[model samples]
Target: MTNEPIIPTRKLLLVCGCLLGLTALTVVAYYVDLGVFHTPVALGIAGVKAVLILLYFMQLRYSSGMTRAVIIVGLLWLGLLLAGTMDDALTRGWLNVGAP
Candidate 1:
């Protein structure tokens, strides 16, 4: 037993609780009116859930730094794509003489 660490049962249970709590909150958020930024808020909530999974359930907290960097890169790339698409859609048409 050369100091091989062990995660306690209580901490594991707490993490599980957090996951469930977030899931419930996400459902509630879906039902409520988040006003003008509803979609962005929901997307942010999903990102939070993903981070929780990566940090806890996915055990990334105990993994190497490279793995974490990869996760961050993936998320950033996704954000870039989503932002680019939204930008294109919003700016695709201006005054093109009734270009339907």
Candidate 2:
């Protein structure tokens, strides 16, 4: 196994603080209505939180290029799936297939 350097306690603490702050922001976002932007705003904050956790807690920042590439590809695949699902959902109302 490679000799991996340990993450500093101060850095971990800072990340923890940031995560806590983001969590608070997410909670606040729920209470604030943003009309058509509400979902996007909440998702943006959640994405940031996911990135921070992946880079710090998961130690992906120090991971190899292959690991990063795999993760990126996987996330892209997930995004494509989500987009396809959303498209279907958004278009369902337009199908005009009424109930019997």
Best by TM-score: 2
The sequence of per-residue lDDT tens digits that candidate 2 reaches over residues 1-100 is: 7655778989999999999999999899899988999999889999999999999989988888999999999999999999998888777778676522
TM, every model: 0.71, 0.80
RMSD (CA, angstroms), candidate 2: 2.5
Model 1 residue 12 CA deviation in Å = 2.3
lDDT of 1 by residue, 1-100 (tens): 5332566778778877887888888889889998987888778877887777777677777777888799889989999999998876776677554533
Q: Give model 1's TM-score versus the native structure.
A: 0.71
Q: How many backbone overlaps does candidate 2 show?
A: 0
Worst 10 residues of 1 by lDDT: 91-100
lDDT of 2: 0.89
Residue 14 alpha-carbon offset, candidate 2, angstroms: 1.0
